[model samples]
Target chain A: MKLAIMGVGAVGRSVVDLAPDYGHVVTAVADSSSAAVDPSGIDVDAVFDRKERGGVVGSGDPEDALDAEYDVLVEATPTTLGDAEPGFSHVRAALERDRHAVLANKGPVAERYGDLMALERESEGTVQFEAAVGGAIPILSTIADFGPSQISAARGVLNGTANFVLSRMAAEGLGYEHVLAEAQDLGVAEADPAFDVDGTDAALKFVILSNVLSQGERVYSLEDATVEGIRDIPASALDLAAEDGRTVRLIGEATADGVRVGPRLVPQHDALAVSGTRNIVQFETVNAGQLHLSGRGAGGPETATAILSDVGRLE
Target chain B: MKLAIMGVGAVGRSVVDLAPDYGHVVTAVADSSSAAVDPSGIDVDAVFDRKERGGVVGSGDPEDALDAEYDVLVEATPTTLGDAEPGFSHVRAALERDRHAVLANKGPVAERYGDLMALERESEGTVQFEAAVGGAIPILSTIADFGPSQISAARGVLNGTANFVLSRMAAEGLGYEHVLAEAQDLGVAEADPAFDVDGTDAALKFVILSNVLSQGERVYSLEDATVEGIRDIPASALDLAAEDGRTVRLIGEATADGVRVGPRLVPQHDALAVSGTRNIVQFETVNAGQLHLSGRGAGGPETATAILSDVGRLE
Candidate 1:
């Protein structure tokens, strides 16, 4: 597959770097301000070197890369809320051109699934966003393989930042402020971690899962989710839970009725109580009972692998 | 698709009962002694009723069902070790006729994967044995989706009966013999539970997994696996592990090197430490990092659901 990547972030760079290993070629790449276009394949190392020394990836408009010849458009832009703009428009441009869109961005899928599907229905292209949820874990494709209706409910610890904070607090008896500061120093949490610490990030992922689980019977957006983060969870709470052989995890659940993301009490030894940044999702299957999938929920290379897997699935 | 099931055991019965729900028709069913054959669709409830009263599924010879016309052959027969007979022969007959084979029997897959693939190569049919591994866990399909070469290693607690025994012994501080007795009494273990408690069941599953993970570069049989059962684990061992916040599980690990099944220690809070009759498999991917999948490893309906999922995958 020939790929055009829209974004020069960690995920986009990783996708460009690893495409050849997966028997794919990156034809074009675009950062916010610049674009690099090659009809055959882009010089990945040169693009990254140029980006490192200068702010621009190439000496061309970002729109040039969007218009470049490619089989699939990999949308790895930063996630946004509400209208899911620029990202949404980029996907639309790809679909309108009868090209497939593989997304690592949560914006278009979580905020505008109905519109995305509508656009897909009219085009020769398809949309796949496995990276929009559980990074490298094959959750979305698993749901696709096993009919969506067969899954009764899905619940999991989705936000690595929130989970890290809670687990650290539980493990070392540290306060939230201390752990957040430590996580920031360790580069585990972003400088401004509100999106993750406030439950919105996890909420968006669950919202996307809810949309898929509903099978278009009903579309879910961020507003439909009942989300509560770990911001208010105290170290004392973890201590109290531990006394009863339990721990706290920021869990997101998507069912037929709705989606919920909150700090829930799970058994101390439960699969959901994974330590550090590890994420786990449990599906209540109708016939198979409960199925749990866990892996690195977020990372540049991890999310890029998901995008590549999605690209591989495109027909 | 029209399915011909070659067993009247629990799993085959569930497949017959649930075929309609998955938009499939069971045209033929066979027990060790009798066969029920229909070109269109058989009466599932009537077959079960006959089996319960008369100890036979129908009046015809078992060979008749194998000869019946069907799109897919579901081999749910009792698993035999050496030569993997009659199950292997049943699958061969189906493939010779260019019919897809979805197997719940582990024998043909664990012992004769190469032969099975050889048969599939010559015929128009393909072989799928998801139910032969982790029942409802979707482990095989997940590995297939990720590409076998992309996965580095796989390790987990795969046997439900052995897991039940180990987990019960750990939680209750009971001896292995006591737990095994309780498990047998509760119907979790068979009367002659040598296959499961002796690690052969888990070894066979791991052998099949190793075969798949190797992508036919190498084939593994039960004899190739280094097997160790939970029979030797004592109450003192469980107590010692608990002191260190760990538990013993019949863990099976398969990689490019080889397959090993034995009682191993895992963190109490680890995903591999799933309790009761539950099963879990963890895959170490080259790029995606560690991925854990857990679910009901075995049951009539659970295994049936996996068989149905495989059937759905067939073209």
Candidate 2:
């Protein structure tokens, strides 16, 4: 299929690199400053060269993507959701043109899932957001397509930042502030990890999941459905749990009764004990009961891999 | 859509029970011994029903299900392949009649996946096997329907019996024979647990996943493919890994070349450590790099939920 990338950040580079690997044609690359397309497939294959030298798609105009005949539009940006009207609008235009949008952009799906889903449905196209929630975890697809028949509950350590913080504290007996510093130093936590620590990231993911589980026009909660930040979790509590054969994880859980997005001190016997800096989500259904899923949640290449994995479906 | 069940065991009953939740009709039940089903809605929506009491239908003959005039058929019989005529023959007969077959049974797919897939192609009906490998995990659907975009690898711990045995032996310091005896006594392992203990079970599951991964005919061999059983691993090795802060898991991994279906020891920090008994068989794709799913592998209720999950999909 003719695949066009929305940006050339880490996630976008990952998708471009894997385009040929998955037997797809990377036809165009679009960014704030630059937009490039190669009918010869030369620039499409190697346009990531600029990104290799620590630069993004620097010269691409977003409007250029409209002119190119692309089948799939992969949206991967730095997640300027509030200020993401341009990229969101770009993907929306692609979807309106009957091209499916494979989103690594959390803004379009997280903030406006119902509207985007409605748009995709109306276009008879798809807006695949597997990477938007769980990185490369396939959490969204599991809850959406597989969900109509399978899922009963979708819950997990949705935010890698909080999970990284809690995992470090529990493993090394470090205080929250110390671990938070370490996580930031190691790139596990962002420099300003408020969205993650405040549970905004997990809440955003849950919003997407809720819509998939309910399979409706859209699921919106203006009343704020129980969003508990992981910042207040005491390091001492994690130390105590570790001493008593347990682990502390910032868990975002969803069930029939709305949703519960919080940090829980899960027992060591639970799979959460294996929690690391990665993201882990579990699927609970009548058949499978409680199933555990763990993997690297935050990494440039991994997130990019997620975008590529999704392009196969969306593109 | 109206659904009729063949083999009213645990999986069948679970589907029967959850049919109401999805707003579908369970028209008939066909079992070897006692045939029973009730069109009345399932009362509770739980993962597993410990109770064994339910409304039953028809005690006469298997042909009764064919006469029910159903839209879909749920085939949840014991594994019946690599022998004489398998029970999937019954499933094929239903397919020939133009009914979509939701198979929790892996026997036919493992041995004759190509033929059945061809038959489905001819019939333009589906033979979904959601419960065949990992009940309610939804691995096949992800790879088949949505994987065209970004799939790379099909890997996971496909066997729950093996996972449970390893978990028991490693966590509690039990021996193979003792755990084997206990698994049987507790009705965890099958009568001839070769499929689980050996890599045959995983090998069969790989056949199903391969179809979705490559969108080509599943070509494999239990002989040529690497098959390593879990029985050969010493408990002391598991203990040694624990000493080094790690865990031992029976990983059934399938990559591009062939498949590595066997037991392998991985790090405690790895995602494989989180998978427990009756749990996930995850798939790592190009788009969705690593999707870890967990659930009940085998049993009546989990199988029933899986079958019913497919019913929800067809609807």
The DockQ leader among the candidates is 1
State the lDDT of candidate 1 residue by residue for B272-291, as single tens digits.
88889999899999988999
State the DockQ of every prediction: 0.80, 0.39
- Per-candidate TM equals 0.98, 0.81
Regions of candidate 1 where Cα sits further than 4 Å from its true position: none
DockQ category of candidate 2: acceptable
lDDT of 1 by residue, A1-315 (tens): 999999988899889878888899899999889999999898888888899999889988999988999999999999999999889999999999999999999999999999999999999999999999989999998898778988999999888999999999999999999999999999999999999999999999999999999999999999899988888888999999999999999999998679999998998877788899998899999888989999998998899888888888884
Backbone clashes in model 1, listed as residue pairs: none
**Best of the candidates, lDDT:** 1
List native contact recovery per candidate, as a fraction of 1: 0.79, 0.53
What TM-score between 0 and 1 does chain B of candidate 1 receive? 0.98
